[model samples]
Target: MSAKKNDDRKSVVVVGGGAAGVNIARPLSFKLDATKYALVLINPRPFRVLLPATLRMVVSDADNLGTTALVPYDKIFHAENGTFLQDSVRSIQEKSLTLGSGQEVPYDILILASGLSWTDPIAFPDSAEDTKAYLVRNHEKFAQAGSYLLAGGGAVGCELAGELKDIWPEKEVTIMHKQRLLFNDTYTDRYRRSAANHLTARGVTLHLDDTVEGLPAEAGPATVLTKGGLKLSADLVLKTTGPTHPNTDFIPSFDADALTPAGFVKVKPTLQLLNHPNIFAAGDIIEWNEQKQAIKAGAHAKLVVQNVLGYISGNGSSLKTYKTGFEAILVTNGKRGGISYFGVLWGLIFGGWFTALLKSKSLLVPMFRKESGLV
Candidate 1:
């Protein structure tokens, strides 16, 4: 809401070209005075990834799903619109960024949305080509597998089981979790029951309260041992377990106290770093007390952009504060079925074709394409 002086341009650098960076940079590019502010987006990947669609890509036999999820950076940003640096951040100085390519980037304001890491074969690839290759490799493995075991009953695990079952109905698919609920300590009891019922209807075996002890070190199909003394064999076993690593190691000089024990950067309600006001954070890298969903990240990006403008223009009051809102989750079962839970006390659940129409049909790929300016 604040305007900067047009005499000298200010550099605003955004590290990580995911949802947070793109949402922040793209909107600010049109809102901010081009002559007085420059927006620079830095990410290792050549394209912005729509992470939600990854589960479908892994389970389906199609190759186009993964390709459609990766939107090119050139389509989103340009030299005139903003600077897009296709490189990783080696380290972060007070007001500068050191890229892996040995390039130094200075900025008056910085937004860190570098994201986090998940287990292999499920995590996003490094580049567009890598994404394609990853999808191809995993699709082949899935197609050839007789039995699939999904470790963890989170959204990813549930959706994966459903997709696998939908694609190969005769194939054996099981979801293993250490807890009773499908969502496992995240959602309410109602949501948990609903998810369990949906998966049950889809013929996805649920091994609740079961822990996977280990898998063989062999390269091919092998037996999996469970801590509960259960042994199961699967042609493919994918672990979507918790304990994700944050991508904040690049900021070695950052105040350790400003980071959570889990390593996520802690920020004020205004989305600025607590210790360093000039630095902001959003997306999976933030320590926000909310589900790390793309919708939430996009909302966070807007607040970060507003705060960054206020911080650089010397109008601190112009910065807006973020408030946690109604929690919601959309769990898609496949092309024709899914579930959506919104709110807490008065939460509403939607299933069947309604949920499929909302997500499963195309996994919102068209929405992402338009969001990244690909259209």
Candidate 2:
């Protein structure tokens, strides 16, 4: 962490260095006037984890996948105007933030991009080495397991099943989702069916509308009992039922009404907190009616950048409003197969070839590396 220089410049502090946080901080580092503002980004981790490629990393022995996924934050700032602090925020006040190290950082502008709290296989350990070791352990366990049971038929669950089948074709793989469709009802039935068919063609079993009752905590041979009284046997069990909640426990201390019942921050069209103009939020933490993808979080960052700069420019009236555009998602089955859906023109869905060429081939690892200044 860089020592804060004694200056009169106002501070612009950004919390959480994930996709949305980095996107907002990186641009502000260049665009924000250093003479008028001191930019700082606070995150617990030293590196950003490429979440989209994590499933492939755990299922395959591709060493480079893990290496490339965890990008360092050394080169995120273009100059000396910005500082990256590897610290977690303990609480947030009206005009300042208290970190876990007992240091209080005052800010004229604050952006919350804390994202969500995910389980293992999707979420990794803090340090790069620990995360790599964790992935290696899971990979070994996956190799040794004779069968796999994945709870929830969302993107993560489907992708993990595909990766497992791709690696061990003879291994029995089963997906149990409470919903009838693989994805949520936000997508067309035709698109969801197509995605399910792709997985089924690979001999992946689907147990739709059946909820798993008790999920095993450890990886071992066990029989999982579902709510529908189905006894499923598997050597390993993984849960991809999405994140537990938005990481906003500290927000209620500052403003109780700022968060929704689900704990996500309530933001205006400009992505600013409803009652606090100086505070803004993006990523999965924001109350946006769209798919919580990294791409959408990046879009939120861009808009927040424009609005934050505009707010400080003494022209707050002209802040741009964020409008949720068409819903689009690309679900990768494995390294060479997947599905793509664009909710436009009565919903257009693409098959494996297009998805493979677009996302499955490299999982956009190279693009993220370049964006993080690794390339």
Question: lDDT score, residue 40, model 1?
Answer: 82
lDDT of 1 by residue, 1-375 (tens): 113323467788889888888888888777777777878888988987778787887766554776688787786654366878889988777666778888887788888999878665567667767777877878788888899888888888888887888889888888888887888555778878888999988788898988888754332376888988988888888776643698888775556576778888888888888888888899988887788888988899888877877777799888899998888988889878889988777678888778899988888889988878876
What's the true lDDT of residue 131 in model 2?
82
- Give the least accurate 10-residue stretch of model 1, judged by summed lDDT: 1-10
TM-score of 1: 0.93
Candidate 2: regions farther than 4 A off: 1-5
Question: For model 2, how does the per-residue alpha-carbon lDDT over 1-375 read when each residue is reduced to its tens digit?
Answer: 222437888899999988899899888988988888989988888988888888888886674787788888998887866988888888888678888888888888999999899887666777777887898898888898999898889998998988888888999999999998898999999999999999999999999999988788765678889999999888888887878889899899899899999999999999999999999999999998899998899899999999999999889999999988899999998889999999999999998899999999899998887677678
Candidate number with greatest TM-score: 2
